[model samples]
Target: MYEYVRNPSLIHEGPLSKARLPVFLVHDGGGTAFSYHLLDRINRPLWGIENAKLQDGGWWDGGVPAMAAHYIELLGKVMPEGGDILLGGWSMGGLLSLEMAHQIALTAREAKNREGEAGDSGASTPKAPIFRVRGMIFIDSIFPLRLAELVGPLPEEPVFLSAEESRKMKLKDKVNLNMTHARMMVRFWQVPQWKDIPVPPTILMRAKEFVSRDSDENFVDYTRDLRLLGWDQYNEDHGHFIRDLWEVNGHHFSIFDIKYLDDVTRKVRKAADKLDPPDF
Candidate 1:
């Protein structure tokens, strides 16, 4: 029933190599798969992950979780055998990565359990392929509930609340004037389930920006929690998304910048290299 999931077409800077495992890169809020063209600029072979119905008005109305699941299903197809997939996202996409990682880990565990039972019971259960997700990378994403109070209260529609409550809720998140998308991301991130994401995730954040508005004490507390969780946190001197000066439509999110994109792709490569099965 999940075959409807699809991967977006992409333009590539270098030749596609089957030797390299595919990295499925999802875009942030208000972004299409095309928005991740920076991955091409970084000379990485990434399958740009986007929703097929993104052009339709109601595609994102169901909230990020639904879209996240769609992307994850599509990712399963491109990911190589023996667990060689690298999953990464920016902003809202980072939240999606968390959800995807949780699902992948759950799927992998269940598959292993089924295999063991087949031998013990002498049943003819076919060997199911293991969905090995190597690593998850988060860039400039918020910690749970950290920025919600600063962004003000979440609205009562779609991501903010429910779609039925206000038809304009999704539009509110799409508003580029203020940081509405950032606010909604932080609000839902507060859910305890997000903390349960079962993967070795590296969080690359704009350190100064996320904590600049808060007191030094609060910043320390926040960083402490991140460290305690064994999160590999890195600092960036840019906005939540990197700066992209060549954006055709006057959008200036930096996560699309060549320099920033290169930095992240390298980090993802290094993390993947360290995976137990060796994702070379």
Candidate 2:
């Protein structure tokens, strides 16, 4: 039941050209594609992967790897044959994007190895990959941690007791959907060590205000851990190349708010433009 928005309108002026690869975006935890309506400001093809769970009789029961695989299949259908692609997402969607990039890289590697073997064995190799991820963009996304740490506590009164009930419930309430997504995130993190793999040219648009101000006595800054553990290691291991981080105004959610839409779109477009084909 997942819906794909093919010709999404741009918030600012300018039409997307067919020559360039479209940027595929995953929805935030609220499972709302409209949440990213502001990104239309970027003068490029934009595709939003609407959450299947939000639709009646849709399927999405929490598992980052599974979710990534599902999207990869969908991506193949939309992208041109052997074309380049850009992947990005906000919040929980960002984490999903990272995973998708990793899977794409793995698949590409496998294809390359197959081609090499074919060359050696005098066999016909496939012309090119179905699609290659050119860049990855993360908007205020953090590395995964325990659910209890991320969200204080689970609600005592369950909104949708069962998947069947969730399917039946109206998707009008954003709060309800957010709560459901939060639980799914918790479950996603509970799975055994789902670490991030090295991706293509990447950029992280961090919300400075939110991470700086919002801190309870016991709150641990996962973003700090991301800088130290994820970003730092990635740079060191990859020769200090292919990654950029920019601090933007507003809180985590508000960074994508209408007031900062122009700023956000500009940064994203800049990052996407900077991407180069991955060197095997």
Candidate 3:
């Protein structure tokens, strides 16, 4: 599910390994990690967790919970002794990251029980994987539930689907699968269950514009709760504590453009550094 963007970068020699905290990023709507290549190298180990549909022909289990659960299993392959890690993504990817954190917290109890059993079995064995999310970075990400509510009606069927593809899918299957995954994402988060889940330290990067607005106006400039992108509506239980915001120059889809890469990288690196210091 995950692909490395930075492979134990040369910046980390043997002694500096202590500073290597991998950032496992979830994929955006494109269902692949291709766009993440645009990020300015922040020097930390980088990995992108891709959607299963991209390779498995849309037959994988659906919903954010299933995706989150599977991604956690995959994380074990790279960081088996799971400790602290930063979680982040763009747009829908960010929404999915939020679910991943909730799933991690939800399973912590079971993990603890299993960890006890492992400890009892052997004293010299490697620690069983039990990951902790240190913080989250949401790039122009709004809660899908809020979005679905705002967008009200979905089309009966997207006009893109063709008659022949319905009978025997070809390349259009990718487009069909993308819509399937999107619906699954919206459906899963539409229900309000993770409200009680603690909100971790978060860095929310809002684009200058979600859509064209009045001259000199940004989308957050009109939100009821300031710049949160309507997240305060569902995140009602846990008030913002470690949350920070960084405004980027561009629309939601175009914010990852190369021109803003350095600025974006700086804000993310600053947030990650605060979330997990070297001593941490």
Models 1 onward score TM values of 0.60, 0.73, 0.74
What tens digits encode model 3's per-residue C-alpha lDDT throughout 60-159? 3456667777778777766766777788888767877887887787677567767788779864434557778888888777655445434335444333
Q: Candidate 2: where is the Cα deviation over 4 Å?
A: 1-18, 56-62, 118-129, 146-148, 154-175, 186-198, 211-242, 276-280
Displacement of the residue 117 alpha carbon in candidate 2, Å: 3.9
| Alpha-carbon local distance difference test for all models | 0.48, 0.61, 0.64
Candidate 1 vs candidate 3: the TM-score winner is 3
Which pairs of residues have clashing backbones in candidate 2? 11-40
Q: Candidate 1 residues 94-134, lDDT tens each?
A: 66676666666676777778878887998866543356565
Considering only N, C-alpha and C atoms within 3 Å, which residue pairs clash in candidate 1? 158-162, 241-255, 242-254, 242-255, 243-254
Tell me the deviation in Å of residue 36 in model 3.
1.5
Instruction: Give a tens-digit lDDT track for model 2, residues 104-220.
Output: 777877788888999899998645435677887877766565535555655543343366665566776644556455555545453222234445677777776634544441232
- What is the C-alpha local distance difference test score of candidate 1? 0.48
Better of 2 and 3 by TM-score: 3
